[model samples]
Target: MKEFTFELPTKIYFGTNMTEDVLQKESAQFAGNVLIVTSGRSLITYGYLPKLISIIEHLPGNEKVVVYDKITQNPKLKEAQEAISLGKKEHVQSVVGFGGGSSIDAAKAVAAGIASDENIETFLLNGREPDGNVLPIIAIPTTAGTGSELSKGAILSSPAHHIKAGIRGKKLLPRMAVIDTSYTWTVPERITCETGFDVLAHAVESYVAVKSNAFSEMFSEKAIRIVGENLPKLIRNPGDHAAREQMCFASMIMGSNLANIGTCLPHRIQYAIGACTESSHAAGLIALYPSWIRHEFEVNPRKLNHVFQWLGYDPVNDAAQAEQLFSELKTEWKIPYSLSELGIRESMIEDLADQVTGNLANDRLSEKESIIRSILKESYLFRQ
Candidate 1:
């Protein structure tokens, strides 16, 4: 065991149909005006927005609730800026992220922006660290992936600059997280697959990351087991409430692991792919997994074996077997297994590799650009 420090400041409420009670109990955090940040009108279309607003309005000390529904997929810096502007104008005291990871990430960024009165672009692009003066945030996740609800980081993209990266700080951790499985019941099948795979990615990456410790590994292993078991069930029957609950649980715990140890090369590289193309985050990760896992086998076969065993592959020393199983899983779930499938081009590989930010230290890989280019090229043409 290695020496490490861990902290999870967010109070988590996990279950089905407990959002109201949880909000009522934690209403002090929602005192004064509240801002609700979402990706779009899906919450409104699903009738969740009105219900959430009504609940917040009824909470003790809650004065008003405003909705900022312009958050977009991949959550750009401009969206955070706009939401922060609205929050400031409305005098919102706290923010509630009311959808998937994108909304939750945007909400955190908005809270930080409002509190500091600083443009979030400085943090995302200029390497400015967020001071611990962020407005209180409460995350209400309607998806079972990204685990952004309990995380201490927010991923925002700057399309204008062609850069996507994370803004990380302890202050960015939500003050509270509400995970109601019932809210995830209506997620479309395609999203379900993508986000569920994201859960697996978080677990696997954290478990294998060089920064991982005993505490983080415990949560990572549990999340991996839960994802392997329940993701398949949800794929077969999207309405499996029990499976949904399990996945939500897995997602929540994996979030803690991510906060503690973080992910590996794939997440770092995926940022470049995201910056260059309009690929879903998880799709890029899935495409990069084979090369990543192969690297793990070469550098740390023992750790890779532990991860595969958790996913129910016994005696899995062979990297090819592991890659084959992953390919099969992607095919069954209809997830693309190649970067080209997500519209990434062979010609763009060099630039994509150049756009990659951060170090691969956590992956135990060389930080050389050629290593990264090789991985990208392999994933571009990957086929099982």
Candidate 2:
């Protein structure tokens, strides 16, 4: 019912075998050499990176080239600093992020560091604003979640700070997004489902966010349908291109949805879970979602109920809806229903709750600690 405006500037290339051409299109925005940023060694093994290099090398007037494949899960400040040093040393004109969320996020951090005079560590910790122009970044996502390919946010871990924080701004958004579903073929079935849950969570958060608008809802609505219908199917049959394409399409739409509306409880909570427990972000979300949403259920049950509706269930109430969504996802993927089984502790609850609420400056975070603890308790007890 509230009015809002939205803007998404990244040019998206969707379909099979379009990753190469999308990079070429994005290349027009930059001149000279480019930094090739990647993660998980997938580029080197699956022949994805070599093929990309072939295309980039064929282009005329492309001179400077560097490869920074030192990215790791929960990409760190040291990595960004190294990347910046390499970027400055190489004087690259652009960066191509080739991999999943970590790689794309590292690409954003690399761009942020390359564009600025200050250290990115301070920015990532305390949420500093970018004041300089960033080099063009072309994102080619090999996974379907986190939406980092199109998001302006990057999360980095710093041992010095002993915390995980995010650097966010439109400047960090990729100049172009190459989201070819064909590339997702190499993704493991478990990751496909976990990341799929992240996309599903993205749409749900975007739909009910305080900043939601008509346009954001439109994107989320379709995204929820696409992901709800396709995620489990993809898990069942990871090679199905149609389902993969639908998941990719939904991922992008969810990106747009979050751009305008932003995310709240579940995403913020998942951040703490990942920072502390090192649980897979999406899987943590899958564990915490039912509990996290319960705190906000009375706020808008019907809106959240739509998630179940789209997932082919009738949610008679909050409990039923949560069970239906989680149960179905777990059943399809054979995912366990407990956080402890995934290596989370009950003792982490108090601290995690503190961080989840402390991390935000918004009014909603002012609730009593019990409410926060209760959420984590539910997450601990959640099972299909």
Candidate 3:
């Protein structure tokens, strides 16, 4: 047993209708103004905006709330700054992150940015902590994945820098996180699959990260198992609400696990792919994981074996299970089986590898490049 510390600071409000609960319970803490940040028409068309107005209609004077809806697929620093400028202009005292990871991440930047007129790029580049208390942020997650509700780190991309960076600290954690599984009821089936993959990736990478401890791995192990069992079921039968609910729970757990234990090679590689290809983060991860396993299995069999068992693969002579898990990711999940299948160029592999090596993540960078490059090659050449 190794030394470990455990702390979960976010106030989680979870139920079939917890979104409404959060609006009711936490809305009054802020001043007259509120900024609701969201993405896309579906969430808006699906009642997010209407319900929000209803919530504010009940506020003392029934003042209309301010909202910024310009969040993009993968949040960029410029958009986040734009959202912040809008929030400041509205005199918003509260911020609501009302969609997936991108929206929530944008909301985080908005929350901190609303506190100052200082340049947003300074915060993005310097990691300058927001001074004084920030506007209260409530994360209303519509997706079962990303679990940005529970995480303090907000991933924002800087196109000028062409990299993704996290503004991470306990203070940035949302004051309230409302998890309503019902919001996920209408998520596109493809999003359901891809986001669930994100959950699985978070669990697997965090489970094997060097910083992982028993406390975090306990959550990661259960998260890995539930995701392994339920993701395929949900994909095969998209209307299965029970499975979606389980995946939702597992996603939150895995998100917290990642916050504590951090992530490893697969995430490092996935970042570069996302930066290069402008594809879905989960999609990028699926493209690379098989290769990641192939490259790391020899050196990290114990970790692979544990993930295999969590994934419900028995008969694990560790090495065999490593190969078996890769097969499951390919055959069972039916994820984009290769980087090239997703339109990523073969030439992108080595450059992505170099970007990953220079990435300032939790792991050491010096000796990690070869393993990353080999994984990238494996992803390019992997077969069904």
Task: Give per-residue lDDT, candidate 3, residue 278.
Answer: 65
Per-residue alpha-carbon lDDT of model 1 for 109-201, expressed as tens digits? 899999885678889897666975999999999999999998888998898999999888888999999999999999999889899999999
Best by TM-score: 1
User: Distance (Å) between predicted and true CA of 136, model 2?
Assistant: 1.1
Q: State each model's CA lDDT, in order.
A: 0.87, 0.76, 0.76
lDDT of 2 by residue, 1-384 (tens): 665778889988888887666656655654688888887486688988888777887666777568898888678789888989999998888988888888888898898789788888778877886668888888888888878877888877776665767888888888888888888888888788888888888988777776777888888888888887887787778788889888888888787766556787777766777776566667777887766666556666777677668867777575556555665566666565566665778887788777763233221432545665776787786555
Decreasing lDDT order of the candidates: 1, 2, 3
Q: Which wins on lDDT, candidate 2 or candidate 3? A: 2
Which structure is stronger by lDDT: 1 or 2? Answer: 1
What TM-score, over all chains together, does every model reach? 0.97, 0.93, 0.92
Stretches of candidate 1 above 4 Å error? Answer: 367-369
Instruction: Specify the poorest-scoring 10-residue window by lDDT in model 3.
Output: 357-366
**Which parts of model 3 are misplaced by more than 4 Å?**
60-63, 127-132, 318-321, 357-369
Return the clash pairs for model 3, or none. Answer: none
RMSD of each: 1.4, 2.2, 2.4
At residue 353, what lDDT does model 3 achieve?
A: 71
372 Cα displacement, candidate 1 (Å): 1.3
For model 2, what is the alpha-carbon lDDT of residue 251? 86
The TM-score measured for candidate 3 stands at: 0.92
